[model samples]
Target: MKLRIFHQTVYRYDRPARNLVQSLRLTPSVSEGQRTHDWQIDVQGGIRGPGFRDGAGDWIEGWTVRGPTEEVTVTVTGRIETRDTAGVLRGHRELINPLAYLRDTPATKPDQALRDLALTAKDAADPLGLAHRLSAVVSDAIAYMPGQTGFHTTAAEALEKGEGVCQDHAHALIALARLHDLPARYASGYLHTTADGDAHEAAHAWAEINVPGLGWVGFDPANRCCPDERYVRLGSGLDASDAAPIRGIAAGHGIETMDVAVSVEEVERFQTQSQSQTQS
Candidate 1:
């Protein structure tokens, strides 16, 4: 399937701020499952900086706004041709060892409850099977309630509350996967939601576990499925903050606020219309 994406993030400060710097991991992953085309990132009134791929094979770019300004906007527009790869991340190059992801972050640290949950899936025969079972257990344990959790909510806290959005689900699953000694990390990306009235978040997240032979495989417990053609993988990190599409800081504390809008849609219909118009 061919998918088109538009994402805009606007940052507003009540008082003028200064010297803003941003690191963006907003590009789609280069893998057998997807191929990117015509991608662009624009930051209003900002100077583009150096870009490089990190050890985890994620593309990162830096931008700076020499601001005594009040507002900044980041816009991303892109298209991707995607295939269903059964959630297996293939043909992606990285220097980091898989075991590196076994380390924990504040948002994914497992507590006693999480450890107990991981133990339930201990009887699984192999790493891949265990990963699947762990995802299932998390799906059943946490109810998807949008406002039930916050950005800093830890895996243990979300599990105890029994409700959260995709971020919480991914964090909880990562924590559980690590408890079983499966190397796991948080993945940030976009998901195409259809007209079926499903409440899937267009800006989404999932957990990727590095199985022995398979490398990295994605599991989204909030939706109770593996990542498929409808999903576009961006980057992976220890947790959400580390994997955030955009991370930046302002030199002056001017009390900032942000608003984000994202949309992902299949482009086949749009292409067909363009073709018809050209022929006519």
Candidate 2:
């Protein structure tokens, strides 16, 4: 599948703000499953800094907006040719040990209930089987409801509520995976869904479990399947906040509000457009 993505985020402040700094993890992952083309990231009135690949194999870049202004906008445009890899993250380079992801984060911490959930899948014969079972368990536990949860909702909390969006499902799955001694991390990316399909967030989140002999395998409990050609992998982290596509802070006491728009779609026809890097 050939997928095109357009993502834009706008920040508005009631009072003038200054020295807005941002860290972006918006670039797609380089793996056998996906190849990126003509990718670009633009931040209005911002300066681009050096970029590097991190221990987790994610591309990280820095940007700064020296603003005494009330607004800032960041836009990303890219194309990815993807194939189904059965969710196995193959041919990707990274320095982090899988065991490192076994550590818990606030968002993925399991409580008594989560522990019990993990126990249900313990009878699976192997790590891969157990991983799939865990994903199914989370899918059954959480009903997909968009407005029922927020960014701060934790795995235990979502499991208790029995309802949430993709983020909650991913968090719950990560918690359960860790309970079973599997190293799990949160993955952030984009999903292409047709209009006739069930409503889903174009910008998506899922969990990646590091299985012995398999490297990292992605599982999306929210969609009840492993990531396929319809998905574009961006980055992974201990939790959602860490894997966020954009993270930043601004100087000044001004109250800030943000709006995000994302569109991911499969293109039947291919067209090439010229793109250039810009820094302000």
Candidate 3:
């Protein structure tokens, strides 16, 4: 299947600030199951800065506006060709080491609740089964509620609250998988749902677990399903903070406000192929 994605983010500040810096990880890399045909990013208000060069994880930054600044808009548009491998991403190309994925971040610490959840899946024979079980457990345990957790929310905190958005769900699952000696990575992307029409919100997150034969398999605990062709893998890291689409700091502030919108549309399969052949 092929997909066309349009993501737009707007930031409005009450007072302009000085010395602002942001990291952006909005670019998508082609992999075995996915191919990038055409991708472009447009900035309206602020200047695009250099992304982090030396890092094993994805670098996310935002634009900065000096004091007396008001608004910034970032628009990203792209088209990608994807094949569904039953959530199996194969090929030996190692963009990220499996060992590195096994490492846990501060916000993904597995507390007693997470550890107990993993213990329930310990009897599974294979990694795929474990992933299935984990997805089911998380979907059943937590309600999808926004504003429940922020960038600082930990797995333990989210599990205790019993409610969070996709990031929280993904983080909890990552912690549990790592505790069980499974190498798991955090995936950042956009999810398009027919129920929601054309409204884009914050970035979406999920978890990918490594299997012996199949390599890495992705699971969206929030959606209660494995990632298929409809899913777009943008970037990945140990946790949501690492793979965040945008993050930054400002020097001076009187009051800051932020607004974000994202939209993903699945391009018609026939149209995508025709476009591909025309470009060729």
lDDT of each: 0.94, 0.93, 0.75
Candidate 2 lDDT over 1-280, as tens digits, reads 9998999999999999999999999999999999997799999999999999999999999999997889999999988899999999998999999999989999988899999989999899999999999999999999999898899999999999999999999999999998889999999999998768688989999999999989999999999999999999999999999899999999999899999999987765424322222321
Runs in model 2 with CA error above 4 Å?
Answer: 269-280
What lDDT is obtained when candidate 2 is compared to the true structure? 0.93
Off by over 4 Å in 1: 271-280
**Cα lDDT for residue 269, candidate 1:** 77
Q: Decide which is better by TM-score, 1 or 2.
A: 1
Superposed Cα RMSD, model 2: 5.1
Question: Residue 153: error of model 3 in Å?
Answer: 2.3
Model 1 lDDT per residue over 34-72, tens place = 999889999999999999999999999999999889999
Model 1 lDDT-worst window of ten: 192-201
Number of the top-ranking candidate, with TM-score as the measure: 1
Q: Number of clashes in every candidate structure?
A: 0, 0, 11
The model with the greater TM-score, 2 or 3, is 2
Sorted by lDDT, highest first, which candidate order results?
1, 2, 3
TM-score of 2: 0.95
